[model samples]
Target: MTQVDKASRKPCIALMGEFSAGKSTLANLLIGSDPLPVQVIATQLPPVWISHGDAPAFRVDLDGNQFAIDLDNLAEAPLDETAYIKIFCDEELLLQCDLLDMPGISDPNMSSEVWQRMISKADGVLWCSHATQAWRQSEAAVWASLPPDLYQRSLLLLTRIDKITSERDRQKLIRRVRAETEGLFLQCLPISLLQATAEQDDYDVWLKSGAEDFAKHLVDLLHSLSEDGAVGPEGQSLPEAAKPLRISGLVAPDSAPAPPPAPAPQTAAPQIMPRRVRLSPSPQDRACARDGAPGRPS
Candidate 1:
């Protein structure tokens, strides 16, 4: 099937994972608001394509027909005939890129076609795996099966890292996953989505949650995709050497000590970081980020 016209579209990043692995949570976190209800997110719904706007919610069927639907009653959308649900949000982050929240790869009640059919619509992915059982065999097999071009630009995020109480065990788990999927992903990072989303105003808590590093890497990745010619027009393929992007100040997973906290921006920055993620003020010449507060100057 033909995907969106890349020549005129923003980069699309897919949120993928097994059921309850924080895919919905990550989506909510990124959008800075919940576009779908928790109950609706938990159901076996199709991919939700979110963009930056106030357009009403709608559904796209397998036959490529469009049907307007009430966002509050997403559960009522016929799953058997739907290809994806389109929801437009006004978050500034959506201005930079689009987010496609996919179904859990491991849902027993859902068919692979539900998500597989939407993969081609993505430019990259944020693969969420539960920290307690990060990177299961099934997940790895599925990830391995994806086109190398797609996987190369994606990041494997170990969601709910806060659940792994022991620092030692957390480090060990990250090490193991990184080694096993060494070259399969751009990077494998651990994060506590709950903490990052809950403690938006507290900078230290947000940084400790690993949201800072993840945000930096994510911004860098998106910038590269847009500026480095990583994503081409409709019919073109990704470049072979477009794998690594410069992630300034990003610490290794095994030794990702939180950087020393800097003072919060004097003013809210652009919404580059997640709704909760705020960076310290940097030189005015450097790129500005979210909440009217700019990110650290490059």
Candidate 2:
């Protein structure tokens, strides 16, 4: 794609994991709204492509046809024929990027083809593995098949981290996943998605839940993709070489330096330099010049 085309299209981040890995919960937390139904019943639904807007919901069939669908009745969506469901919301996060909430890779009720079809559409992925059973062989097998380009932009999230109980165990799990999946993901983080979502009003709780680091990295990723002049390996832009923004306490600290000012706007279109004019002296003037006098030729 051309640079403009790549820049114009919002980066698509796919959320993939095993069953009940808290993918939906992370989606809800990042979006700051639950556009998709988060009930157990809705877990079995097809991939949901969420973008920014106030448009009504629709489902895309395998043949690339769109049909209007009701959000309340999404659980009834036909799994076999549907390619993916499209959801739009006026959330701030959606304004920066799109989120694809994919089904579990090992869902017995749903065919692997269901999510496999949608993987190509992702610019990045957040692969959620349950903290208790982090980075299983099955997860690794599937991740191995993905293109290397996606790996640079992708992340491995150990969800339900609160269940791990001990800091030592948590750190050990993080180290183990990082070692095993080295170069496969940008970073491996343990997160309590449930706590992050529940503690929306409490910054300290949110940070403790591991949402703060996740959010910072996420924003950096999106900003990199948006500002980079060229498309990155997976069509997402990699982070620029400059220093990253310093975030503090769930927001920018007052002491932090402000972002550089925008360039001054040009008030007028640039004027083309006039082509150099060669003025041939008029015949009379030429004669007078030859005569070395200021009057007409006598």
Candidate 3:
């Protein structure tokens, strides 16, 4: 790949949502590990973590010194002065993509400046809201302030989808939230992060939580971003070509291969087709080929 192509290949997706929007849960699901600390109680601190080899989670202070973390307790760790903590995991799927599991956007205890600085480093965002009370005006208003570049790459996820018992309620929230966000998001998917975790063994859970659709959507979005050449709001090129889902580091090494048998395999091989090309010499090559004009300045 050319340098320009290589520059466009790095895929980074940031998860931004209100407190306890299952942001950590979603990350766990995608990574196939609950190793990430998740709880209803607000242990809200910026864990600027990413996945790779099963490296240790180190406390990275402002000076960039690395200290081992307890994983059970990050609260005691200082965040205001610390640069960020990096958690390395065996999940190879993250190699191609870097995930920024950011803290809540409008937390009273934590200043916006904390998350805002991280936002500047994101390539795209996954904004999760609780399905029970989704797409709140506060969420919309905050999302509105995001620049158009962010808007184009952002996706809204209505988490805790199983909370809505009735199908009527599901459709209602879907339509309602869709209307509110409209064109702001590339896609908005309703997911039951809880159910998804519970039925991790069951194939139905993936579809039920809407992760199946969400995964497909994410693949398309990541590919589009790669092709569009807009890595961030700054319009820097993204790194080499990749289908986000198939990325090496984002998923676990021993993760199960997908169940077989589709009318057409979803992981279809790229089709090659013959095409026409002009073999004629250009003005720049006139000295060699004479531009194919009879005796023209050979």
Candidate 4:
């Protein structure tokens, strides 16, 4: 393919994981708004797909005919071999990329075969695994099977990390999880999706949630993956030394953070270190998440 042909094809990043692992939270952060519905909906429904769009939403059936989804009624939609429902949003961040928010791979009711269909189109994934139970044997097995190219583009997110509370415990858990899935993901990031959501506007919230580190890595990775060059197994340019483009975004997940960048022109400052996540529709999970809850703002 010509260099121009390759540059035109935008990368698609899928937010994938078990139910309630905070997949939607990461999506919301990128979209810079609460476009994707975050409810307590569990397994019995269809995929809540997202892409770049002008309107906040429209539901597309298995055949791709666009129809309005109440967004609220996703759980009631038919799921029997009807393909997946597409949810469209107009988030600006999508201008440079596509985000696929997928269904739970571990749901007993859903077949692995179903999620498999979506993998080929995905250039990368942000795999959300719960912090305490980070990488299960099942997750590892599946992640191991993905094309290595995807791994260079993917991020393994350890969600709900606030549970451990202790710095030592958190590091230990992160270390063990990475050791178990070594070479499977480009990088492993631990962040409290819940805290990030509740404290969306706070820089400290983003850093403390560990999202700052993840965001920096994401920007660097996406910039590298978007280029058109012979990719090496190391995820860099082959033969020629790869000088990955430095991508600037509204968010920066850094350690010794600086002032948040101003929106748009003035500074193109990183986004408000947004840490927002909406809860999915769940009976028991909701209770566990909120039992020790903080005031959840929009």
Candidate 5:
């Protein structure tokens, strides 16, 4: 085995979730460009590791053999032999961190080995769960097996919030998710990736879509992870204003409290803050939540 060098690595954030959980859309929103084709994303592929550079796209095999690959035809990479596809982009967001877009955890067609082998490469994770069926047992089980330190650095995202039509149900879902996942992540945010992508220039739409808050939180997470010395280059210290509130604890509660009944969603939009990435963006099912609410298995 060759020695692994950690002195010059940037923090890597992995985009992970069940199939169609908006992981690819989140990747596109962050990059501000569609590097991963929608058709390719819809198909099963190994982890696509994206970094900041102008290098040509390439594929690395399980045995560490490298070969150039056409970015236009990503579907040709052999799933059984390929380790990951290394793609470079000049996006500002990539300057701060590398994004590893992993295959869907729930895809029956793809073996877990494809993604499991890549988890060690991540400094943090953005676990996307579908709003209608958020935080299933399988997701929690997988998360429980990951590095415990990641709980402080990671986030739980409820994607496709627009599917829940009523404001009452939306707030109810968000609050419940936050409560249930209180100790598991930095924050649990709700977002509609499609809405954020479609209305990137609209400030109010960004706020209402939950993208604004997600962006700010994401930036903060990057800073926190970098400052905490998680594979960040030297001389990078935590800024005075960037002290994240989530890094102080790693204690998981014995049990999360049951979420209270639904409150009417706030009509006022959250204030927006500028972020490097335009697209920004958790929970379990329980009986308390109804009408497309998440209900954790009893």
Candidate 6:
């Protein structure tokens, strides 16, 4: 396929969830490096459209105008008037799919319009709900409005599963979310974004952190999108010119096939650990916490 065709065909997977749902953390983990500014600054900006390339950053205004931007000074980009900031990188995972790091759905400081406007660009969604507060009413209400076709393509992630601590609580939380979002998502997985991103050098830690299983399913989903004609937000088919490409470092060497149908609720629950819950700003959060930028509401 030609370069332009390949770019158009690359499946765009949006990372969405409430504020502090670890969406940014997951983005950094998948990309194998943090390309955007720290979360403090990032959460305030428009949807960051990340794709596979080496081109410098630029902002796409609401009028479809493209203006050169300096990543170091991303704060200067007017969030109110911009459509989305396009960030290009050469990450391997990005070669197979474009990851749109969307702002929190319920961000009080930012309007819903910011993310709503970009929904049309997504082929699928990786919705990250906090394990402690999985599937809130607001989240459910918003998700209910999404295209029905996307329900089968979307994956609901109960992030920060490690925070639940007890196995019983973890199982209960998973079961509850599963029941509440039945048929609304392809599958639900409990994961610790912090653990997954921190255990890069240790294969065992990486697998145990739930990244392995997540990666396997994600790759399979991308492959499926490439083969099938998944429709975009506008009810138009997304581009499908390129063949499926293997992501090098994200999936484990011996990753199992997409997790088998989840076992019956009474069976031994999956041994996925809950994620860390930080009341204070994390190092990353603190990095952008300077200048009294509005903090992400819990």
TM-score of each: 0.77, 0.74, 0.70, 0.70, 0.76, 0.75
Best by TM-score: 1
- The C-alpha local distance difference test score for the whole of candidate 2 amounts to 0.69
Lowest lDDT sum, 10 consecutive residues, model 6, at 282-291
| Candidate 5 root-mean-square deviation in Å | 12.7
For each of the candidates, the C-alpha root-mean-square deviation to the true structure, in angstroms, is 8.3, 21.6, 16.3, 10.5, 12.7, 13.4
Evaluated with lDDT, which candidate comes out highest?
1
Where in model 5 is the C-alpha error above 4 Å?
A: 1-7, 230-298
Estimate, for each residue in 64-109, the C-alpha lDDT of model 2 and write its tens digit.
9999998877877799999999989775556557889898898888
The CA lDDT at 143 in model 1 is 90
TM-score of candidate 1 versus the correct structure, residues matched by position: 0.77
The sequence of per-residue lDDT tens digits that candidate 6 reaches over residues 1-298 is: 2334434466789999998887876776666566776644543778888887899999999999999999866767887899999988786567667899898898889899999998878788999999998999999999998878788888999998888899899999889999999999988998887776455445576566776567656766786776564443333554443333333324332223335565657766666543221111111211000011112222
What tens-digit string does per-residue lDDT give for candidate 3 at 52-164? 66776777776768788876676667868766667766643465466778787767888776676656566789899989989888888878776677787888999888988
Q: What shift in Å separates residue 213 of candidate 4 from its native position after superposition?
A: 1.0
**Global lDDT of each model?**
0.72, 0.69, 0.63, 0.62, 0.71, 0.71
Candidate 5 lDDT over residue span 1-298, tens digit each: 0113322467889999988888877777666666765456456778999887889999999999999999878879999999999999775567668899999898999999999998888888999999998888888888988889889989898999989999999999988888878899999999887776555445466457876567668867887666655453233543443333221001111124536546555995555432222222111111110011111110
What does the lDDT read for residue 141 in candidate 5?
Answer: 86
Candidate 4 residue-wise lDDT, 1-298, digit = tens:
3444434455667888887677766676556566534463333555556666765455555576666666666665666654566666664445445677777778887777666766776777999998888888878878777778777778899988999888999999999988987777889888876665455446567558775566567756665656543243333443322222221222422234457655577656645443322222221111111111221111
Ranking by TM-score: 1, 5, 6, 2, 3, 4
For candidate 2, what's the RMSD? 21.6
